[model samples]
Target: MLKIAMFTLAAAVTASVLAPTAHAAHSRIQFLAPSGNIGCQLGATPDGSGFAWCKADEHGWVTPQSDACPRANVPGAIGEPGGENLQLAEGQAPCFGFVMSQLFFDGQYAPPTLGYGEKRSVGSITCSVERAGVTCSDSKSGKYFQVSREAYKLG
Candidate 1:
């Protein structure tokens, strides 16, 4: 009985020591440009594609409560729906709107470009860029949305 109690205590101590480390690893945040208003947490999709989700804060500070993109019905390897794609020029910033935003490159001196269908996870919901526009669909949900760069101005 004494041996069993000591083993149980040791196991509990081991778990307590490792619990915070595991949680911290999972909550690691990928920092984007500190000067930019948008911050993204990046990872891989189930199909081995890059994935990321971003939030925008006007003050260039990112927090958990910042506005993020709509959650995808299907998630990537890291369990997110979006990826990074919009490249911005130097001195440029993100332009966010209802459930969408424009992305910029880290350094350059050109106009920012819209990241339409640039980042996506492969699953029930799939997205692609075509001549007509950026198209996405969730087969399970039977939902679809599109964006046209020609119809909108970049930030």
Candidate 2:
């Protein structure tokens, strides 16, 4: 009975020490720019690689029509749906994406604002919400994507 009690205590202590660290490392990453124009998400892939993504509420720019986008007659698609969202994957060039849908939730369902000048990092990728726009990049690849109402850039 004494040996069992000591083992149980040891297990409990070990779990307490490691629980917080595990949650911190794998917490979900999702937020929006304070401008209310951009939403971003940083997360891990099935292979454990990280990627960053952001989308604009409105933009002056247009993406080249791809068959995948099809100038859809759908909501949240606006004009050219394919290019409204930008993505930067680990060690890969930034690219435009077709959001496919634009359904949005109201009130508490909406993600919290990242606020201008705020930055978040997940592994090697870092993203910043700025007055100019939202920018996300990969340190190892030196690749980034920035987007706003007026323009966007990939490098």
Candidate 3:
């Protein structure tokens, strides 16, 4: 009786741990290519927030990993092609804990643009857009990136 009870308990615990991973593995990757001069292929979540990679354009790719709006938000709608930047705003407050990344012409890591008082985190790197363009710092690794643009340059 004891062996049976222990076996049943262990099986239940294992099932609980593996259920979420199984469900996540089943997530589908959908592609979206809108009509017009967008010149990009977007991969979005079922709730409508993901990434876009453009081909043969000065700007490379942009990703907005947010959990707010769920109705087909595009990179052009924010500010792309012209500014070559993208933002990821999360949570109910909308723009809080946002992470933005800019696509550089030289295929380098461009610091993301932030709002007047917005702060963002990408892994161990924390960044923000100030009057001097976008500045990112990784305290753990003692690394940083700062790019300067005109005031109010971020769109």
Specify the highest-TM-score model's number.
2
The candidate maximizing lDDT is: 2
Candidate 3 global TM-score: 0.27
**lDDT (Cα, tens digit) per residue for candidate 1, span 36-60:** 4444443334453333334333432
- Model 3 residue runs over 4 Å out of place are 1-113, 150-155
Model 2 spans with C-alpha error above 4 angstroms: 1-27, 66-83, 99-104
Task: Put down candidate 2 lDDT per residue, 4-92, tens digits, no spaces.
Answer: 99999999999999999997656447788877888877766656677777888777888544444333222123455356567677877
Error of 1 at 66 (Å): 20
Give the per-residue Cα lDDT of candidate 2 at 126.
91
Worst 10 residues of 3 by lDDT: 90-99
- Give the whole-model CA lDDT for all candidates, comma-separated: 0.38, 0.73, 0.35
Off by over 4 Å in 1: 1-102, 106-120, 150-155
Q: Number of clashes in every candidate structure?
A: 8, 0, 0
Report each candidate's C-alpha RMSD, comma-separated, in the order given. Answer: 13.8, 6.3, 16.1
